[model samples]
Target chain A: MSDFPLLEREMNGKPLIYLDNAATTQKPLAVLQSMEQYYRTHNANVHRGVYQIAAEATDLYEAARGKAAAFLQAKGAENIVFTRGTTDGINLVAQGYLASRLQPGDRILLTVAEHHSNLVPWQRVAKQRGAVLRFLPLRPDGTLDLDVAAREITPRTKLIAVAHISNVLGTIHPIRALADLAHAAGAAVVVDAAQSVPHMPVDVQALDCDFLAFSGHKAYGPTGIGILYGKKDLLAQTEPVQYGGEMIDSVELYDSTWKPAPWKFEAGTPPIAEAVGLGAALDFLTELGMDTVHERVQDVTRYAYEKLTQLAGVTLYGPGLNQTRGGLISFNVGSVHPHDVATVLDACGVAVRAGHHCTQPLMRWLGVHATVRASFGVYNTRDDVDVLVQGIQRVQEVFLP
Target chain B: MTPNLSDLYRQVILDHSQHPRNFGSLDGAVAVALKNPACGDEVTLFLDVADGVIQRAAFEGHGCSISMASASMLTELILRRPLEEALHLNREFRRLLQTGQADDPDALGDLEVLVGVKQFPARIKCALLSWNALEQAIEGIDGTGGNPP
Candidate 1:
């Protein structure tokens, strides 16, 4: 916002407490300015434009695709496709690949801890293709039961889709191990990295997954922009789920030929401005260092987990107190409903997410309709946790009595 | 400025939420289970109807303060009102929730403890979940899925 000066406000007659990072992170000033600069000075459609502004916008847009590819450590930008978000990306692969390949009697393996976005699309496609959908069980503490996953990944399994880090549980899975196992079984794997990408460093090639999906909003960027990193051969072989302009090689009265890999998958105009914002976010993260971000989140989550349980009636879920997890904790206090917990916290000017968090199956597995989530980001401090703990205690006092 | 917590959590309101009145099943009475699935707040409102009048009303479930307190207050007023009056009360609630205009705020009395719930739009559902269930029960409908609408 260089051209447009930014503004900040206080809450509770104090500085605003923002702890809702897992839901959507607040973009840094740099990200905001990059977006403002692009819109103000170089506002134009990309790829199909011929004017000076169009070329400039195209450079920024294509540069963003290249940057996203580099961030994900993919070999080429062609393997990176722009999607609406993680949900859209996974839905693309499900419709494009599963519909064409998976058939009757084929088994599609998924973990019980997946978000509804990740779980539902595969289930819908599997049922339509007459495939049997199976779950790779979960542990009491909410981590996936790897032994159960092994047993479930049988010869009939044609595809496997699992979350890299569960949105509800916050447990980071052995994605590479799962990918190797799926490949050994002659099945492809799709990794839902929506939770992991924001909190940890990711390299899709090293992870060896067929496809990986994550959203921009969670990664300190604008919404409606996401990255889908698919292996080159697989992306080429799969059909485009969405048909529109910029995706066709040539069109005739009788028939049309589709483009290759990334562009073929990215139908319509794509999220141009939002994609630029994502690129800027990635650069900002790189400057701060993902390792440091992950470390900071881990430090804060562990602190909150230890201290939060000290309050009476406080309950915690997700990875173990010591187990490495994404930067959030989802839990409930006493018999206080999550909505009540959230409302009371809001009254104290502390924000937290309260709902199924789009992981309803995980909610059912945990035997609760919803849980309040407090997630940390690079911008968050230990003071935020103090506020959360203090606020939660207040909720218990209000509800328990 | 920090909003006063006491404004939302009055003692009388908290009392009603903690020890809700007329809270049990009246067997063979029409019931509707309405839940704000977003927050796991559930309440099953039991309607005891006789001669097209709401003879007695009761609620049995758990939720937030606004939710439980409103249900307790709802049972108290809905008991003596006729079927049409209860429907009208529902309309007034739907309106007063948006604009604190009530021709008979004293008629509502301590039930007006719910008026401040209007300030928090998200919690409005908590205050109205029971009333919605009551509406469904009177009209021969079940809010949650099981049988058809």
Candidate 2:
């Protein structure tokens, strides 16, 4: 065994219990070390330098883009544009692609289970462009009532943006089916894979979505870097929203000709170091093997749902235990506010998230203000779930018994 | 490592949570209601005050054991004390939530259980809900030396 500190140092002197990976992951030393090594060894700007340091930086930067593209099974490196994060990536598409394309009568379709980052961008674009915004309704089980989603995708639908996996519900949406239906409606598909990419196999080609976005932090990488995967031809068609340094080709005083594809989309210095960190994080995930991570999260999520449901005070939300959910579960203990539940969990050094989780619409759908969520990761063990279960049982011993 | 949450939620708290003292309203009396809307903890206090003495006090709300127990114990503590002294304890307990220690012990027994709540940070509102309502009632009745009621 490696004699290194477990990353639970933030738990404040009690037993180290971490369950907020869905919010962001605790960086393993590999990611941290890669970032540190980058800063220590070669710290220079990329793409526009003749020096050896600059050459190294540029090569690594482009290599990171290639790694990201391959991870998503995108067509080429040109299809992967580095951005601040998934929200920035989606906003870019909304502003660059849909803003100009959407007309007054056109419809933008989405699901209520979408995080605010995915929901609000389209709303702003729709309102600004006078386009009609429509939502796919949710079922009692907190899934996008897929039947309704299918029925709602009409001829007027221009672009369908849906979460690949719901952050709040932990239910994996039918991305493949949704993509097929959206394409049949003659609409483009944009997937918010922020929750999906880190946990499962995401072949954008297989899902057949035109574009996909996911954040690095949610996938155990540095916070600021994310990948926006677009089809090569579609990326060439969309205009670059952000205009600044490093995303240029021929510039005259009167008019400028911007670069094409990935470079055109990545404006300014870009999260260069963070992108390098993302590459390292990808390397770490590769070492663990994404398939193993997928299976492990599935097992853990199922175990969590089952264990929490069997407990007397707890109520499981989203899909049923051992069902087709992803790496997390959101639940509420009886009569206890999620905030209180999290607080007691914190007292026991069991850190769980307790809030709407940025899915206010989904919260309203579930008839809950918030819920105590325990998300799983590769580092998580059966012991962690047991700790959470025992903690909740202690809550019963404390308050109910 | 396992954390024993039994240390946090004592049986006294469960006793109060299950069978809250002064559980109903006083009908015609000074009432003050407050809610921690962020977390959905609500408390409505019915104080039967006459001749500047709290004759009886009761409450009803939906909340966690901490808030409910705090409400139950708060009612029991202030039942017969002079309105001004009850007001004093309310102020003192609020201070204890912030400072985690207070000078008054006789007026605060198991009430000390929630003093540890300050450590949790997010739940200070849950622990302080009833005490805040009690303070509001005292302030409303006397008006803090403003106009005659």
Q: What value does the lDDT take at residue B138 in candidate 2? A: 80
Report, for every candidate in turn, its global Cα lDDT versus the true structure: 0.83, 0.82
- Model 1: docking quality category: medium
Per-residue lDDT of B96-120 in model 2, one digit per residue for the tens? 8889788786578778776766665
**Model 2: runs farther than 4 Å from truth?**
A1-5, A8-14, A250-255, B1-94, B103-113, B125-149
lDDT of 2 by residue, A1-401 (tens): 12114653646557677788898876778778878887887778988889998888888888899889888888789889898889999999999888888888899998878899999999999999899888888777767666888889999999999999888888788888998899898999999999999989889999999889999998889999999999888888889988888888988888888888889987788777899889988887888888988998888777787788788767888877535888888888887767667867787678889877888788778877678889987777788899899889866655555
Q: After superposition, how far is residue A146 of candidate 1 from its true place, in Å?
A: 2.1
Q: Estimate each model's TM-score.
A: 0.93, 0.82
* Candidate 1 lDDT, B18-49, residue by residue in tens: 78999898786788898887677789998877
Docking class of 2: acceptable
Evaluating just chain A, the predictions reach TM-scores of 0.96, 0.97
Per-residue CA lDDT of model 1 for A1-401, tens digit only, reads 12112114455554557778888888888788889999999879887889899999999999999989988899999989999999999999999977888879899989888888888999899889899988888778777766677777988998999989888888899988888888988999999998888888999999999999999999988999999999999998888988879899999988999988888887788778898999999998888788987898888988888888787777789878767888888888876668778878888777789888988777788888778899887777788789888888788677666
- 10 residues in a row with least lDDT, candidate 2 chain A: A1-10
Error of 1 at A43 (Å): 1.8
Let me know the TM-score candidate 2 reaches against the reference structure.
0.82
The true-versus-predicted C-alpha distance at residue A27 of model 2, in Å, is 1.9
